[model samples]
Target: MSILVISPHMDDETLGAGGTILKYTDAGEKVYWLNISNTKEEYGYSEELCRKREKRYYEVIRRLHITDAVDFKLQPAHLEKYDTGEIINKIGNIVDRIKPEIIITTSPGDVHSDHKTVFSWAKAFSKSFRNPWLKKFLLMEIVSETDFALPMGSFIPNYFVDISDFLEDKIEALKIYEGEMGEHPFPRSVKNIKALAVNRGTIAGTKYAEAFMLLRCIEK
Candidate 1:
């Protein structure tokens, strides 16, 4: 199976779908990562920070065993500044090239503007009639962003994947993003990630799990 994960930033994937991704790759499936936004050095971010972020990105991908990845390098926190149609067309081109069986992406209801923009373009490009090869469309939950969304756009997951065996691997991969994780109260902390996983697991009757909103699925 071919799985494509669309992330708004470098660490979003690891925070959201890391364990499930590890499970798929462990089963010999092809997993591709498409990151839509980045912290560009020219965006007033220090060169040192950009370099550090890039290095952490490589380390995370290496640990996840994902060999196929693409970074669009668009400026972070300003994805909406780009033309929606242009972004959708660019993403569509990648979809046409990969022809993935499943696509997991950031949620439209996420609190972060970048996440919402990524979801918008990703959803536009993955319409069933436009891409029959894409059998499943799922929206992953990112801590610190998805949880903080307004009640009207709150994430209500209808799908769950047990990541009990791979939970540790997921946490380890996320650890590479040293700048992202923080203390116990921080939403992106490792403790809370595990807590959320366990909570989702309880709903799915597993020891640890990742939750997603199943936007669509087609069985052949």
Candidate 2:
């Protein structure tokens, strides 16, 4: 079955479900990545920095063995500026082309506006009958974004995937996104990533795991 992962930014897919991605690719399942947001000059990012980040994204795809990927090139953090219908249509077009059996995207509760916007559009398009190829929809949690949204919203994961052997691969893949990693207390830090994986794995009785909030599943 084909799997599509929609990411709001360059590293979200890796931070959210890198290990699970590895498991799928290793199992010979086709996996595609769609990144919706792009860095903007107004965001104070230099062109060099943007180029570096783009390079990191390519590195991530290479690490994951992903052959199909697209960047929607939507302005970062300014997704709210675009009409919702337009955004949904853009995603719907991609859905029609990919025809994935499973779609994973950012969580609605994520603190980042870009992530939330992408999640809303993805959820809407995936549920529409016009796109019947989508059978499963899941919401993945980003470390800093999802965790910081508490008190306003919470991420309560109901689905867990064991990544016992792929946990290290996830961490390594995330590290490819230069300048994203932080120290121990930082949510995006390698230490915290491993910690969260271990915590989720403990709950699921595995050595390592990734957690997701299952949105929909149609059984054949």
Number of the top candidate by TM-score? Answer: 1
What is the per-residue lDDT of model 1 for residues 5-40, given as tens digits with 9 covering 90 to 100?
999999999999999999999999999999988878
Question: Residue 153: error of model 1 in Å?
Answer: 0.3
**Structural similarity to truth (TM-score) of each candidate:** 0.97, 0.94
Q: Which stretches of candidate 2 lie over 4 Å from their true place?
A: 40-44
Can you tell me which runs of candidate 1 are displaced by over 4 Å? none
lDDT of 2: 0.87
Q: Indicate the residue-level lDDT of 206 in model 1.
A: 98
> What is candidate 2's lDDT per residue for 1-220, written digit by digit as tens?
8999999988899999899999999999999999988775667789988788778878889999885999877788888898999878887787788788989999888888888888878888566377677788999978999898857578999999999999888888988976778898978998899899999999999999999998898876
Clashing pairs in 2: none
Relative to the true structure, how large is the alpha-carbon lDDT of every model? 0.91, 0.87
RMSD of each: 0.9, 1.5
- Give per-residue lDDT, candidate 1, residue 58: 83
